[model samples]
Target chain A: MSVPNAQRQIDMLTKMLRIREFEERVKRTFTDHPGVIRGHTHLADGAEASIVGSLSHFKKGDAALATYRCHGYPIALGTDTKAMMAEILGRVDGLCKGLGGSMHLTDVKKGFLGTSGIVGAGIPHAAGAAWAAQIRKKREVVFCFFGDGASKQGAFAETLNIASLWKLPVIFVMENNGYNVVTTSAQEDANAAAGQPLSIKAKSFAMPGVTVDGTDPLAVAAAVGKAVRRARRGDGPTLVESKVYRLSAHGNIIAPPGVPLHYPEHEAITVFGKREEYEAALRGDPVPRFRGILVQNGTLTAAAADAITQKVVAEMEAAVKFAVASPYPKLESALDHVYA
Target chain B: MAQLPYIAAIDAGIHQEMRRDPSVLYFGQNLATTENHEFVAAYGHDRVRVTPISETAEIGMAIGAAMAGFRPVVELYMAEFMLVAMDQVLNEAPKFRYMSGGQVKVPLVLKAGFGFACGWAGQHTGSLTALFMGVPGLKVVVPSTAADAKGLMATSIRDDNPVVFMHHYLLTLEHGEVPDGEHLVPFGQAAIRRTGGDVTLVATGWMVNRALAAAEALAKEGIQAEVIDPRTVAPLDLDTILKSVAKTGRLVVVDQAPRHATVGGIIAADVVEHGFESLRAPIIQVNARDTTVPYSEPLEAYVIPDEARICAAVRKVCKTAR
Candidate 1:
């Protein structure tokens, strides 16, 4: 597999920073602009390296589907962040016209097909898109992203079995963040209890499985690039377990109307009382670590890195301003688009 | 026109679309297994293949494929099998278009047999037309006649939305004269099987035949009962039913599902609300008794609606009006 060039590496850093900055504004929206985002919104604060690196192999014809922690994928795919923010803010200018909001951010034109609020649900959808690509006689592949918790779902097993059997061109990316909504992986996952990597589940479906450090962009890119090649070659699917840390809680606290919503403490601290573990994750945060690597290797000057940071910050700030100023969709529009 | 059984006509409808549109796909469990399989031989392996008995994946993949610009028809033998993947059926397939704000269209069909009261017992024998009709993005089709079976299937495949094409198992081998080519039945149009001015009888799927038989029996008693079959329930033809009620001044609705779960109740509520003044007597509904469809033959016969019960309900409505 070809390594991303120095310029490409710097581009990856820029996308990673964009994701981090975009989501940081989303988290702050709960407090900075109270009640702008409604319902449960999961942030991809720590999975930037994983999200950006895996998508680095994406091409024009390729498609990707993800779970509810979905803001980062569309941002990395170059969807207008202003519309994404408008969607989160429930404005008419939103990506889905405020119908789907943060949990269901979809940009079909960019090949980020859709997102599923249900876990393990979007896996077969990617395989379905892969089937379409297969019929088109194109080497297009689909990237299926889900969390470690989704592996236990029946959809996961059933989809993997069929995907492998049909030799469909799709890559399964499981972001192993070690938590499934307040429960650690060991408490629920059999492989985790046995001290085996979650990637081992791919063996049951007769496909190659690999585990990589998700915080390292190059590591994730190299691993996912190999799988993309396998899929494009029509050899079948490969499961890549990119192990990362969920630096935030599962989502903002779910509250009834009139109660202010905001992000809670990391489950490692709130539920398990492991402050140091949470602190350690923050220290090894992927965004700065990748930036440090680029600076150390002379791919980016420290001055250039600061400039990129300032640019992303301003872009996201403008997105927030545009979103908060936008108007809500007309009440009658709720009846539209229900049939076709 | 050619004489065709309901099951064959459904296949003919699929063949019609597969011949016309290259993007139409047909796949499910226990189908197209070998080289000589009809669909495989006809469309090749790329568009037709057998899948494992994984309902969630089978339906889920169809949704993905539909969104990606292929029209897929999933052959689920029994309606209850959809319960195994209701999330994909009810939640995923129907919600994608609206959720995407018209960005994508899921043009697919879920073909399943329902109301199989021929000793299939509780699980397999369910009239689930009402369950899907209420869902916004889904179009529910219940074709009673062989001709309608072919026509409605064609319309469903061509429509740019998710459709649940429910064919009654009891009517699978029933034969009728189906048009030879490209016969398309529009959704939301009710078929008036018999026209009369004394009393109106409304039904769907297997119950349409039962209602027709009851209409014949009612004619001997000097009760001219008008019979209407709503080919599609989602876009229900309330206007025709209301117009029939206006002429007849009496009504009886027959459904094979339990009383509480019948589409008859929904129609009754609509007629009463919209056409209440036209009603000369309280409407009567001949629905199955509320219980798990029993395994015993006698119990099954007693629990579901039959021609005798439909006739009795029609007579009661006619008598009550006078």
Candidate 2:
């Protein structure tokens, strides 16, 4: 839409790249040195722009419930990158005090209710947060993100149905990475007799449902912006499905190679002119694209942009060092946070 | 002082607590307005609420509201219905305090009526009090009489921890005199119904009455049976049972729950573990059969623990006492 405000677009793209870069480092660290930290790790590899764009629409105090693949949302929502890195390292300095580890990172101060590992478990919690806002007569919207598999959960439909009926201010952002774990929608359908598009399921609850290109941050931002406005106006919940691709394995640690193209990873391959042509496109990273836009708009300079990127990189590198140096949580602290 | 019936005391406790505290509000499936609306008539519609039969969401909403600093008394029509909101109650409520690193105190009271009553069949009647007792950080109370219900429930409502109070629907019709004015009975304390020199009869829930009745019958035959009522099962009044067993030299525990690992199992295990030295004879446990509470009147009678079973256990324990 009108290419967005040049400054806003820059901010959105910067945040998206920050997520991509942060996750790329996590992948490298996990692969290079195994057993430093271990568990079911789900990183947002291909779905970067979708999270950054949508989350940028809401301010501090508006809440969000993210799924297992939640590293990006908390970072974008202003949780300390150091604390987040510490969490992945299972250090006591981590967010959730290292109690939640990776999948359950939460910064209540930032209004990020903890991400849940159980598929669709956090949907009702998001609805409850939105319901709380309505009861308090506060103009706050809650953004709930989950994967395609989670959308199939009963809690998803039940929560959406109730939220629509109650007119609660909640936005359900379904990040359809074209697969649920190793199984695609096509395989899921062939496995099960009932073959139906999941977006239609969202519409069945009387909420407006639409799909958008998740790779395109601007499109996702526009769609989420509309939903946020609608919710702020008390028009009720909206379901927006973002179609994207996962560049890495479903989890942070990839299975041994020769796993056969799980789902349709190679199906929608964007072909270039030649190997040299592809290398040329790879040089045009989103960081430069964003920096060039900000400079042209006069909101920033090329030199100032370089300084910001360097600062972020330094901060992130320091965070990585902090995590590597930090010790894991004591064994006794394991049962410490079971209640609160 | 004459003891009160557990059901009537529960109703009175809820009524008095609501009147005393303005912040306390109540809601459930048929709480405010049933066809007769007995629960609301005693409390009031503002304080009492009726919901649209959403067991899970209703409990979840109440918990969320509690997290937002509202004291809510949620009524789960039956203890069996608690299964619907088990995740919210077990996962969210208990886990919140620890998850928040002791920042949250779910001062939420959940009222659940358990135990087999009438002929409501398998689903309607099931005593899951012992089931909740297994969960750490949750306080469970099985009040057997009106007085115990009033006092224990009052303490439960004011306690910082989340409490699941179990009352039996059959005892709702059983009335007894309750002391007026504020009287809070401490939890983890047992009520000694009868003092005897022979054997100790440990009981909880409706089984307390049966134990007392059996003790009365045993008294005529010179089989002195000391009947002990464990008002709250979770923070069990173990000292009382141990003391009674120490004196009487024998023990028999009667619980309405199934015969598997239950309150009876807990008492028997704890007594043998802690009070075995003073015991004159091996402990005996009388409980419901190892199955669901059947619907048929005769079959239900056959499954649930009764006075005959309690008396038989007492007689056998006393006869075996060295």
Candidate 3:
């Protein structure tokens, strides 16, 4: 009942490529096109592997809850990219009818429970979703993705304890992008430097926890797949920490706090730098690395990968055009959702 | 129909609702110890859950469960603990429907015990009717009698919107008549506890009982005060309060929330704005002192607006009072 090796590999390549191309198109449309997007956007630049890798393991009807840097998951999960793009553009045709914007892209039908801008905020939500699934005796599991910055939060501590205690079908996926909005004290630098694996905390909660090389899509897939299977089997939750990088800024183009404006000027750098020092330490970009693995294993040809890339590029172009053509939400629609 | 204590009435409501709707979920810290134990025994542990002392997490999880098509009722031990889960209540639950373009319905009920009756001190006091009412999306309910508590609790569970159901800590032990089986007291409906002609007293939660006592005291002095209990705040029953004010020609608002942006002041403003010609005197607001609830019994007693204060306010507003 396993996915055939070549098919699985191809699926990974296609999802990762789709995310990279979609993000690139979004970045250009957001930064270059004037007045397209308003407010903050945290792109999952280098964490595409973790997002797609972790999500691929989840079966249909399973839920995904994540933090703000979540554009990649929905795109890779095959949510209507045009609706998401329109949402980012604040159009009525968008997924959330322009109210949720990029940070809140959701298609619950696809089991994307939605995203929250608050750090560690979505963790408990996943616990709740998993609890509902358990109560209904549904074989659905919830994958909760959080950041290292959020790991130290009280929500993290509390959610882990409750999730483990109730044995909810939840897998905690930590996308450690290594910066907590440029605040040294809040970031996980000290914990990571403590010479201990960050995922080890799951042991304290009496659940399995493992750290995987996040850039290696296969590694993330293996770790998350194991966790997912454990959850579906009613073995309680597992913490799978994928040590990835946020190749984009905390926001799409805006720098994290304390860094000078236009400091890295990533419009052409292709790599988002948190700080010059951290930039050098950043994990390798996952898209190209994943492509090389596929090609080397003879699972995919260079020509095949390029074709997928071209297809995604064309789709993104049309999506951008659709978003631009969509109409702005009516003013009265703002008050529509305040009550039932 | 049968007479039941506030706690038992709430227990009966939850028991019946969970039995009626399979999607209803109940969770909180130490729920196994509360009135929820009966439901757990009947429905099993999955639907009726006991969580760790994770206020913020429980609130977040409740919102999540509600989002995924479950009616989740989260019980915090006390109302003040709601501060820990403010973001989930104020930001997420309310905004979900609007953000999803009216596609999502957060049938979430947040239940908490309020008031200084149990002497649980500062962290356990304050019926925060005004705070939740101030938010646009939330429906705030405060029930006094055991009958009203059971009915309101049932209605809150069935509501397709987020509701903050705050029970007065003092009223939990008091016994009153509650209908057996299914009963729902609709929100935004005011209950007239006592009728009078000289002055109108608008009260909420346990304050309704206090206002009734105050009305009795005023009747002896021939003041004749009307007591109107606004069971819910957000979708407030302003029509009844205004009609009472017009009929009485004098208004005195009473509640446990602080003075600033309090429900008392909100009612006074609405009465003054719409029923200006009907008023014979300036409106009087009897509310708790604008300070954090202190731990001492006497200080706590002084912080809450008592029956004497309501009577005194009624006397001050009525010119023909003997």
DockQ of all candidate complexes = 0.83, 0.28, 0.68
Question: Model 3: how far is A171 from its true place, Å?
Answer: 0.8
Off by over 4 Å in 2: A1-8, A187-197, A252-307, A328-340, B1-25, B31-53, B103-107, B150-161, B178-197
Cα lDDT tens digits for candidate 2, A188-215: 5432226544566656788888788877
The lDDT of model 2 is 0.74
Docking class of 1: high
Q: TM-score for all predictions?
A: 0.99, 0.83, 0.93
Query: What's the CA error at residue A38 for candidate 2, in Å?
Result: 3.0
Write model 3 residue lDDT over A30-148, tens digit each, in one string: 54576677767777878888888788787888888888777888876789989988998999899998988888887887888878888888898888889888876778999898888
In candidate 1, which residue ranges exceed 4 Å CA deviation?
A: none
Top candidate by DockQ:
1
lDDT scores of the candidates, listed in order: 0.94, 0.74, 0.82
**What order do candidates take by TM-score, descending?**
1, 3, 2
lDDT of 2 by residue, B1-322 (tens): 4455666677677776777875566877756666457756765554566665566666655555454455677888689888876776676666555554444456678888877568899997887878878776688888777777788788887776778888878777677767787757898888898899899888877788888899889888888888888878877888988888888889998888887857888989999999889888888889889898888899999988888898898888877878
User: Which of 1 and 2 is the better model by lDDT?
Assistant: 1
